[model samples]
Target: MGSTEDTTSTTYSDASSSPTQPLLSNPAPTYPYPYPDPPPASEPEPTQFLQISYNYGPRPIKDLPFLLLFSLFALSTFAFGIFSSVNRNPNSSSVSSFSYDSTTASCVKNATTSSTLRSPTFLPLPNSFALHSSSSSLLKSLIWTLVITLIISVPFAFSVLVLLKHYTKQIVYVSLPFFVIVPIFVNVYWFVACTVSSTCDEKFPLAYRILVLVFVFVIIGVIVWIFVVNWHRIELTVRIIGVAADALSRNLGLFGVLPALTLGLFVYFVPIVVFLVLARLNGKIVAREEDGEYYCVWKQDSWVPAYYALAIITMFWSATAMVEAQAYVISGTIARWYFSKDGSSLKRSLRSSLRNAFGPSSGTICLSGLLICVVRFVRAVVDNAREDAPGMVNLILRCCVNALLAAIDFLNKFTINFAAITGEAYCTSAKMTYELLRRNLLSAVFVETVSTRILAGIILVLSAIYAIVVCVILKAASNLGVDSYFIAVMAWVLLIVVLGYFVHVLDNVIDTVYVCYAIDKDKGEVYKQDVHEVYVHLPISRNSRSASALVARTPLVV
Candidate 1:
């Protein structure tokens, strides 16, 4: 019994001390009941992702190629257009023999005649004599104005120079307009003097004529080269202007936007209009016949002060209203797009959008717009000052200010988007928008530089086509010869109105999309899930906080 007990104890101790295998891993096959077969390991499902590789941040270096191509295309197109315009049929109805009489403030209607009758040689003596006589007084007014301007500008120029020196900055030599302005002044004086004296009319000096021609050609060449070099930026700017105009028209179609915009414009212009009317009443503004031309002259220089005051008031009132209207329109556009509210009545949506724009959330948008407008206004003032004074130092100073203003303008648009989204103040929305942009710098750059440009270009082309169509229609319908200049003006206005409306729509669409994209990229996957794969692609990861957060929120787009 003692030996059997000792053997049992030894077997128990051995069993307890033996090495054991994990139950979850491979179990012993020889066990009484084998562990259930381990589930077969499977490979991770391939991630369905769109891989986009790009150099993040604003890449002005990458933009060089695009700039060059756009510049070349623009220059070529412009040259072709000019050639076509110059070579058009001389006998076309666009040719007119009407002469503008400044003295009478009337356009003299000449009988229908050949193109030769419209030449300089056929200009009536009464009109020519009137212009010649009036040139003396005009010349005197210009000289006095320049003298006064110079006297006032001297101290300002000195201060600008001092500030520029302290800052240790330099400006491009060409940007200093003194060299150009001086020559232009001298040339203008000489031309006017010669015209009044009638010295170069019948037997003009060939050498002088050739010299003038050479200078003009050189200036033209320089202008052409500059246009070619800066076509990309110029084109972009023009398209943006077009978009704003387009937006104005579209907003008008909606109930509130138009009224708001019109009110803003009215507020801005009413002061100036009233001042002019008062001036006319006070005999400050008068129309006088000089030779055969009509000259409207202000009776007193004192009116200038009042004019400036009215201008300032107008600018302030208009700017505020314009900003308010813009905010309302943009917010309405985004809301409609996001909520899939296309089926809703225009008046209702307009009312809601306008309400939201003027509501508590609109403070930031208004402030941002105000800041941009102020900076831009200052820049414009400085720009005009530079033209008048033409100092390198002042140019340098303005350049620094302009750089800052450009940055403000650049960020202002995005801030508006954020403001539209959350009704946050300008600074708050700007900060958040900036953070998102920093994280997704490459994407923002792509959308801004590439996407915006392409859309703008398409709209610009369409505007041109529309203008051509209008011109053709006008020509076909009209029986009498219409003035080419008049037709051109009409066409230009029409194009601006039409283009402004369409471009505004396009701009809003792009802005809304970009805002949505940026939000999704930073905050998570709401918009991405709803949008088609072509619109957006986000990485699938268990660790993504944004994506997870987004799942709880409804998608902004379908």
Candidate 2:
């Protein structure tokens, strides 16, 4: 018994000491086990997934072929214009004096010296006495008009910024109601005045009068409905404008950049204008009589008309390109400012954005500009056709063309904003923008209307005030003569354009912020928490689920 007990103790001690003995006895579960360590915790089911391959550095050139094609076309056009101008005859008579002879019952060329006839040529040359006498005062008036517009617009833009930043709610509240009420009041007043006037009653048919009244009522109803629908969204619009104002205030350098771009555009236009003038001189001189005076007229070549069209189209394209480039710069810089990490500096953001806009993205800009130019050209044609033939069909055609132009404009607004942020090609940016808008339809519609109307109202008021101030100043201080009306009108239009630029910057900012917010929502992450919070109040849509499902199907790339 003592030996057995000692052996048992030794065996138990050996069993305890041997590490593999218990595993062999128990025999660990094989491949058919019901569970296995919960699959190593499953990576926490990521809350935010990648959507776009967002690039922070310079992106590869997109739509390069389009860029090349546009460059070739522009260069060819310029070369042809230069050639035409250079080959034009400087001594060609624009017009020849003709006298109507009663004896022959026909027109006859007067025996006049070329030099005398040329002095009163009808081409309105810069050195022509008639134009030369008025050109100085006209030029002086124009110079003063531009100077006044700049002076007013610069300060007005800053004031607008201040108002947008600090008084956005007030501006929106005031402008919204004013716009809604004023239009209705004007329409109603006109309708009433016309109804009360016997002359109007006699001139217009009863059916037309009834139609006008119905239209007025319908417009009032529609306006009220819109106002009511968007009333709740005023806060969101103000927030958006405020955000844009903040961005603009931070990047005040944009103001300087905008003027520089305008100057560059003006410089570009000078040569084109010269080309147009020179091209006009390429035609034959003909004698014509107007208002009892025999004068020489420049009969433009057949090709001259076509070349004028081309040059005008080019100007339109260039203007559109410049506008888009401005938008891209604003959008890109704002995006950088929006996504920048905390405590980071963005001193070079504007420069980087400029490089991106005119560098790899220039082709995209050119393409968009071309589309706008084409649409505008088509619209102009439709307008002329409508005037030539007033009918239901032409009217309907005009409406359809106008609608298409509007659609293109709306799509471009967001697509350019998206491309600015993502550095995507135009087509890709357009597709993505469409998807985003589809997902957030209500927000987009309401915010767009509210913001656009408010800005329009601001522009109108500011322009009117500036125009009045200009007229007063011109009357008080300058001897512009009849040019006062011309100067006032020019100054008014100029102020509107300058103010429009400011509005455009803000418009792009609003769009960029909305797009960035939509992206954040899609990714389930917020780059701008404040914007997210403010926009979170936007009514949710059922499309969010489908958007999420689509995201789930897409593989996330690290």
Q: What is the lDDT of residue 475 in candidate 1?
A: 62
Per-residue lDDT of candidate 1, residues 148-197 (tens digit): 43453334333322332232122212222333444455466556555566
Model 1, stretches more than 4 Å misplaced?
1-260, 263-272, 275-311, 339-349, 388-396, 469-482, 528-558
Best prediction by lDDT: 2
Residue-level lDDT tens digits of model 2 in 53-86: 2458878898888688777766766887897788
lDDT of each: 0.47, 0.74
* Residue ranges of candidate 2 with Cα displaced over 4 Å: 1-50, 94-149, 176-229, 283-303, 387-401, 462-494, 541-558
Instruction: Tell me how many clashing residue pairs each candidate has.
Output: 13, 4
Model 1: per-residue Cα lDDT at residue 72: 50
Clashing pairs in 2: 94-297, 95-296, 95-297, 96-296
The positional error of residue 500 in candidate 1, measured at the CA in angstroms, is 2.2
